[model samples]
Target: MLTIWSGLAVGAIYVLVAIGFNIMFVASDTFNFAQPQYLMLGTFVSYTIVVSLGLPLVVALVVGGVVGFAVGVLEDWIAIRPLSGTGVHGELVTTVGWSVIMQGCVLLLWGSAPHRVPGAGSDSVLTLLGGRLSVNDVVLIALAVGLSFGTHYWFTHSKLGIAGLAASEDRQAAMIRGINVNRLSTGACAVAGALLGSLGAVVGPKTFAVFTLGSILVLKAFVALAVGGFGSFKGALIGGFAVGVVEALVGRYLGTEFANLAVFGVLIGVLLLRPQGLFGQRRERVV
Candidate 1:
């Protein structure tokens, strides 16, 4: 029971990250590898505002989101817009360069040491239906679920959402339809980065949230993306939760170290059987 609940919680986090990837992929048709750096920067920013500057948690959250928004928009302008699906190699290199820059900036600002967020509250465990959990963990899980639903609503119903979808499906058509593809891509990046940043700010203080940790989290998110299918929103959600459950069950019975290996092994198995993913559509290029 504990494993089940806890795994669901972790799965929620992965879902958030995977959706972030999907939003960027769909909007810009490019992978924003610097995304994890945004997460790290957001955490550090939250730490600065909340702990160092003595602001309220609400303020920290807002500030973190804003920082993410700014950075994401900047990256899209300076990096993504220029490349715009020239091919994966150029985008990958650009993203990697941005990642290095962000790492340097973080190191310079925060120094080499890892710092914990102040006042993460008592370690007293909360119980629900015989399942033990931490307050922070519960909050993180709830935020992830809320963001997931919110993203779905925004993408499917809103005006900007439709425009963004159009931009992804056909950039030239979107422009011809007066969709302002550049702005749409930037907006998607901002929203996705803000969500990931906020999630990091909320979760970072409770655990080890150094630069490397942020990088590792993003890698897990990518695995979730691959497992869920690259561009399928539904697949991202399902894959994240599925991976989370598997990890939890493995950790409970086997050990912690093997959890990741097991998750990837399962992902590989799935990909081997279903390359296009459970929800992914096979693309038909119109010549």
Candidate 2:
């Protein structure tokens, strides 16, 4: 039970990284492999503000979000926008390069040591439904679940969100209908970046403010995205929680060495059984 609880908490982080990937991928067909790096940057920025510079946690949160937004915008301008209509799929390689650059910058600036942030609340364990977990875990679970579902509703219901949906469905058609696909793409990146940045304060304590945090998250989040469906927020939520719980169970029963292998196995199984993912839709275009 405790293992399940622990997995849920860790899975929430994956949920966040998954959401970042989905949001950007929604507007830009290019997946920002660097999205997790932005999350890693957020934790370190939060740590620097709170620990090194001795600022308020709130300040760290705000600054991290702003920095993330700037980084996203920069990535779009330098790496994505120029190659937009070239039909070159170069963004794929560029985004991966950007991630390497981000990781390198973090190493140069912060070194490789893992730094702990003060938890948002007391870390004391609480028993609920026969599971011992911390208050922070409960908060994280609520946040991840609520955000994923709420984003789904927003995409289905809200005007701007619907516009984003239109853009995602058919960028050229959306442009014909007066939707600004470029702005939409930039907005997607910025919003995704902001989410990654602001959550750093919350996530840092659990994952630690570490250089390799992005590496830790990127692959698992991609797995969660694939498991849930590439573009579905609801799938992101379900897949993330499933991955976390499964990883925890495997780690406990089999051994830590088998945990990653188990996750990869799950990915393979899902791809074989449902290539479109759990919530993914199959599309056919009329020529």
- Number of the top-ranking candidate, with TM-score as the measure: 2
1-287 in candidate 1: lDDT tens per residue? Answer: 89988887777777777888888876667777777777778778878888789888778778888888988888888877788745444867787788788888888888877878753542657999999877777876776667666776877888887777778887888888888888888888888788777766676755544766557767777877788788777788878888889999999899999998999998889889888776777778889
Give all TM-scores, in the order shown: 0.91, 0.96
Q: What TM-score would you give candidate 1 relative to the actual structure?
A: 0.91
Which candidate comes out best when scored by lDDT? Answer: 2
Name the lDDT value of residue 113 in candidate 2.
90
Question: Where does model 1 exceed 4 Å of error?
Answer: 85-89, 118-124
What is each predicted model's overall lDDT from 0 to 1? 0.77, 0.87
- TM value for model 2: 0.96
Model 2, 142-252: lDDT tens digits are 889988988888778888888888887777888899988788888888888888988888888788899999988999999999999998999999889889999999999
